[model samples]
Target: MISTDNFTIDSTKSKAAAAERFINLRQQKKVKEFLVKQRGYKRPDFNRMILDLSRLKWTHEKIAFVLPVAGASTVSELARGGIPNFEHGEALIELWKSETRVDRVPREGEWQTYKYEIGQLELL
Candidate 1:
């Protein structure tokens, strides 16, 4: 007679087994089919748009009026299309470095701003 009590799996082995099970789940027919379908999609040229958008710097109050004027209808567009070019941004950085502006450093929150419309802003 086989004694189940004598045979026990260690915790590490059980964890590894669980991980293998999870990986196998990802390879199931439905998931495989879905991933194959998704791979057929054509992603847009976000890089070019991001390069074009990255040229502007705007204050919080200006974003509401600036975005539409800058030709970007959405916030994500600005995030991807970094302010046209970094030249003016570099200038501002330099000016800020010289202590000419009290608030000059570009912070994390600054990048998400959807301020400036196309006509209202110029790309450097």
Candidate 2:
């Protein structure tokens, strides 16, 4: 006959097991995959875009300000090669495009100033 008198459940062990199970379930559901499937930018492209924006003097804070879904930390991560979700990626690209444009043509006054500066440099 089996003895059941000494058998007891360990609450700590059961709790640990439950936690492990939860973690495993979470790991199996990769949200990044879903985001990618929904047209998120790849890591490389995202990183390149971030770098380009940085070259134009766009700081992490500045980017985060423009992207509704991102904070400074998120912007920093994205700048350091992290991939952005579809919406954020598209917004970043649009921000880059807007910043890259010359808002207006340089007038004659601006051209004359530039020409004078160049002439002064040539005299050196």
> Stretches of candidate 2 above 4 Å error?
1-44, 101-124
- Which candidate achieves the best TM-score against the true structure? 2
Which 10-residue window of candidate 2 scores lowest in summed lDDT? 115-124
TM-score of 2: 0.43
Query: Candidate 1 on 27-48: residue-level lDDT in tens?
Result: 7967889989987653333332
Model 1 stretches with alpha carbons more than 4 Å out: 1-5, 29-31, 34-124
**How many residue pairs collide in each prediction?**
27, 0
Q: Per-residue error at 101 for model 1, in Å?
A: 55
User: What lDDT tens digits, residue by residue, belong to model 2 across residues 16-123?
Assistant: 999999998787677756776867332334554565567667787888898875488998887666767788877877776576542232221233343211212321
